[model samples]
Target: MIVSDLWRYPVKSLRGEPLREAEVRPWGISGDRRWMVVDPSGEKLWAGEHHDMVTVSAARTGQGLRLRAGGRPDLHVDEPVDGPPVEVRLRGVGHAVSAGDPADAWLSEALGRRVRLVWLADPARRPMSEAHGGRPGDVLSFADAAPLLLATLPSLRQLDDWIAQNGGGAPLEMSRFRPNLVIDGDLPPFAEDTWNEVQAGEVRFRFAEHCDRCAVTTLDPATGRSGKEPIRTLARHRRWDGQVWFGIRVVPLNEGTITVGDPVRAEGTRSSR
Candidate 1:
């Protein structure tokens, strides 16, 4: 198999950027999910709760970030060097420094809420969820659980076919799922289901769990509008344990660079049980 596509979300829940090559860190790819939009209480504002969040785009640069969205001038924000630290929670409250007022005011106007932009300088501040297959030392960025999510093209094609057979509209794009890596090859649908470990290029990853589908996946990324889609179809066939699953959540076993077109080998296959 070969790596077909790669992406990183610099800010959690916002639009992500495509990448040809990425530096894989312990928490995740470099510059991924280090920033986030949070409510006054320091709770993360997810796209499920704020649909407009899907419309916001955060691009990381050598200096910092470029924020873009409809009806708003692009705003540039620098990394928080001397910004005051604030308490924020992913699973639990931790330290995250502020991105200052310009970012706060800009995002507030865009989302039409009093929100602030906070940066997690150190991802080790929060531990991965043990309930989600994380061990004592596993770490995560602002990602919901694991460091990376992988989706295969064959499985997606199978799903699209299912959608067509079940009274579908247009076929959904993989972007709807926000996977970090997209793999392609001649393989059966859900081949990743049994994969316990995989090597891509020089990097190795351990399977954490199957990724659970969420309401945010139902959003039409192009329009920021909601729809009943992959989620609806996933419920019919992929549902188990009261949740619909699609992609695979993976934690990095070694820090290295991964590039598009790299060969992927699924090694050390093991039972999920």
Candidate 2:
């Protein structure tokens, strides 16, 4: 198998950016989910609950952070905010960081509510889950299950065909799922189900679980518009293990930069044990 695509979300619970190459870190890709939006009470916000204008895309510019929406001009933050420290959680992991007032103001105006932007640099941080056996260097993420998600081209095509038969307009692009790595092999749907270890370049990842479908998939990553086709199509044909499975979650066993076209080798199968 070969890698066909890669992505990163600079801010948790927002639109993601496609990357040609990226530096891998213990928690995840550098800058991936390093920032997040939260309420005045330090509660983190997510696309799944609040489908407001706050689902804007963000990126790191030479100066600082830049944000843009469908019709809004880009907002930039060159200086960090000064505020009382607060703890934010990704899944269940907690991180103590400061929130910038400018970010809060921008987000408040965009969503027509009060909110703030928090960074993940405080040493008091802890990952959200203990089930995966959080490692010393591992960073817990807001991802549905694992720190990384992997999908195969053939499986996506199969879903597209199935959607077409169900009268869904077109096959959605892989971006809708926001996977960190998109592999090019012809694997069956849920094929990662049997994989325990996979190697891409020098990075090693352990397949953990299947990512279940969520309402966030209904939102159009392009325009931030919500629809019913993708979720509806998935519900009818993708349900497995009592849940609608869509992607495979993975945790990096070893860290290294994985680029597009990198060869992928599965080390062991579930049945091998």
Candidate 3:
């Protein structure tokens, strides 16, 4: 198999930027989900709770961060090198730095709700949830769970076929699932479900768990609108233990750079690394 795509979300719950190459860190891809929007109480906010969040696109600018959405001028904010620290809850309460009131006003105005832009500052602040098969020292960013999620084109095609068979409507875009890596090759559909480990480019990663679907996956990234095809279809075919599953989460065993077209091989077992 070969790596087909790479993406990094500079901010949680916002549309991410696609990349041809990225540095894979133990926590996650560099610049991936280092920031998030949270309520004044420091609770996390997501597109599932506020669909308008999906309409906003966040990218890393040369100096700091840039946010854009319809009907608003792109707002740029420099990294808050000296900003006040704040505690925000991800998997657990962790620390972050506020991007100041200008960013807050811009994001709040765009989403029609009061929220603040907070940088993770330290991606390792949150540990992966042990309920999802995490072990000690497994760190994460603002990503909902494990460091990287991998989705395969073959599996997506399988899901599309199921959707068609059930008359569930249009095939959904992979972006709805927001995987960090997309791989394509001759593997059977959902083959990744059983993979114990895999290597992509120079990085080695162990399987963490299957990614569970949520309302966010039903929202169209372009319009912040919800649908009921892929999730509905997955519920019918991929459900188990009261949750629908899609991509697989992976924890990097070694950090390095992975690029599009990097050959990927299922290692079948954890590497000595």
Specify the highest-TM-score model's number. Answer: 1
Clashing pairs in 3: none
Error of model 1, residue 85, in angstroms = 1.0
**Could you estimate the TM-score for every candidate?**
0.97, 0.87, 0.95
Model 3 C-alpha lDDT per residue in residues 178-212, reported as the tens digit of each score: 99999999998888888898899999889998888
Query: What does candidate 2's lDDT look like per residue over 1-273, in tens digits?
Result: 888888888777777788888777666666677678888777878787877632588886753678776666678875354455676644554544565666778777887778888776631244535564445555554444457777888878888888888777877888777788888876666566577888877788877666777877777776667888577877787775666777677878766898888898876567511
Worst 10 residues of 1 by lDDT: 264-273
How big is the positional error of residue 146 in model 3, measured in Å on the Cα after superposition? 0.8
Question: TM-score of the candidate numbered 1?
Answer: 0.97
Candidate 1 differs from the real structure by a C-alpha RMSD in angstroms, to one decimal, of 1.3
Question: lDDT by residue for model 1 over 5-101, one digit each (tens)?
Answer: 9999998999999999999988888889989989998889999989989899999988599999987899999999789998786674376889999
Q: Report clash pairs, candidate 1.
A: none
lDDT for model 3 comes to 0.88
- In model 3, the number of clashes is 0
Q: Residue-pair clashes per candidate, as listed? A: 0, 4, 0
Question: Where in model 3 is the C-alpha error above 4 Å?
Answer: 269-273
Clashing pairs in 2: 81-100, 92-128, 93-127, 93-128
